[model samples]
Target: MEKRKEILNELEELSPILFKIKAEGTDKNIVVPNGYFDSVENQFLDRRMQVENEIDIDIPTDYFDNIESAVFAKIKEREIEEESKTPKRKIINISRGRERVRLSFLPLLTKIAIAATLFFFFIKGTDYFKSNQSIEEIDYLASISKTEALNYIAANTHEFETEQLVGIEFTEEIKNVEEITSEELNSYLYENINELNEEDFSEIF
Candidate 1:
């Protein structure tokens, strides 16, 4: 208790406003000015009365009760006026025979165009197939050994036309005239004689 009293005395010496406790049995030295509390109490009371008066304000009795119905009635009246002022559409019947006749040739022309396109593609496709087949045949023949190819051609000479062999040259080893029989030679010459020109005849002779 003595320690606390000493600390308080030190604080009071340093700052009187910070340590305001009075000594035991001694009245507080700080005093309020005359009428300060009276003026503050009167201001609080005036503000309280003003707030109470604001809270106790009044409004018309039926205003809220009819607000929703009045708003809805006004909206419905506006909708009705808009509907009355809007223009209505009327459908008129008319003949379409002339229009139909004018466009009648379109379908026929379209069909003809489609057919022509198909025909053109068909012709091109056929030619492509024929050319591809011929190329495959030539490749197959070229892949065979020359000896086997010559033997095969010699064996099947009657089956091939003269025009088919026009550009080909026979090697001397494969073209020995003595190896061909007289009957085969005669038959080949007789069959291709009509197609032979003077140059071919001169070479043969």
Candidate 2:
């Protein structure tokens, strides 16, 4: 410690002499007050020679040997503690910021399945109506004539009343047949054809 203070004092006192060495003519003359100039000049020359010759540059082994390892350990521990105290920044991955989510999509698939089921049922209903329509004139043999068959069916199938049955009257296609009721005609039509069972009569027209 004493040696460090002595070196500091010497550096402070000799700073001006070293600064003068860089002046224009100081290399030849070195102007200063009488006795102080010579003393400062000798110190400057001695320091300059020591630097030029590389004297006292090598570190002594005793410097490391005599040093307190505890002091160095404490200093290193303080440095590590200071580093630990500093706040760490969180890192964000910009490449993954816009990634799309991976989802199961089961609900969407269920809705599509339901809609397809409804559509299938609607198509089935349309086909059923088209195929089972009884009013269409597909069975031409059953109808005698267009206008006559309509008039005959309409007049015979209307409501009528007599002493025995209280319903519509009907006549047989055969000659001299007993009078029949509309309920019997309905039963006959229902038994003969499958489409007439749904009330879509096709025999007349």
Candidate 3:
């Protein structure tokens, strides 16, 4: 009892607010919002995965077992001392500082402006470089040989309007027909026997 009273007297000397709070007992139960722990449990679990190694803190084995009794005893000890004391109203005054705070990002803003100007200059310079390129530079498309262009067009005939594109110079007239000998006709018939049906064979014969 003497030790408890001494502890309360020491606590009152240290913090009167704590002393007053001890006299008026507060609710022990802590209220949490509905589903608060449920919602945050997954987040904590995810954060746990990011940590590669387990962090170990050295704790006394008997710390939790004795902590509740220790806290209760201290509060009880304060209460006895607080019952005899009368409460005083505390007045608090809050006011702003006299000097205005200077903007922190002025230097950053200056650097950004400089960067933006340089970026535009760089873009404009690039465009000027492209526009003022040497006129004497080799023209690859103009250097293309006529034969190569013609071959390219022929190879990719479907890609171009080939029939409409071709003119008199590119077209060739049919040569005079040459008569086939009897043996040649027989050879052609033998080769194409399956291809020609009775109607075609009749027309040919």
- Report the error of model 2 at residue 151, Å: 99
- RMSD of every candidate to native, in Å, equals 43.6, 46.9, 44.7
Each model's lDDT? 0.43, 0.36, 0.40
For each candidate in turn, the TM-score is: 0.19, 0.14, 0.17
lDDT per residue for candidate 1 within 56-171, as digits (tens), equals 64655675676445433443454455346634422222124332111122222222223332333344543433333333222323334334443444445455443233212332
**lDDT of prediction 3:** 0.40
Model 2, runs deviating above 4 Å: 1-55, 58-61, 64-75, 92-205
Q: Model 2 over residues 5-94: C-alpha lDDT tens digits?
A: 676567557795654444334446646677885699889999999896785656555644633342234334534553466344322221
Best by lDDT: 1
Better of 1 and 2 by lDDT: 1
Candidate 1: how many backbone clashes?
0
- Model 3 C-alpha lDDT per residue in residues 1-205, reported as the tens digit of each score: 5798898899899999998787676554667889898879887877787662354344456755764454334334434443335233222121234422121232222222233333333445334324443422112224333343334433443553322222101211101001222353345447656655565544343
Clashes of 2: 0
Q: In model 3, what lDDT does residue 137 have? A: 19
Better of 2 and 3 by lDDT: 3
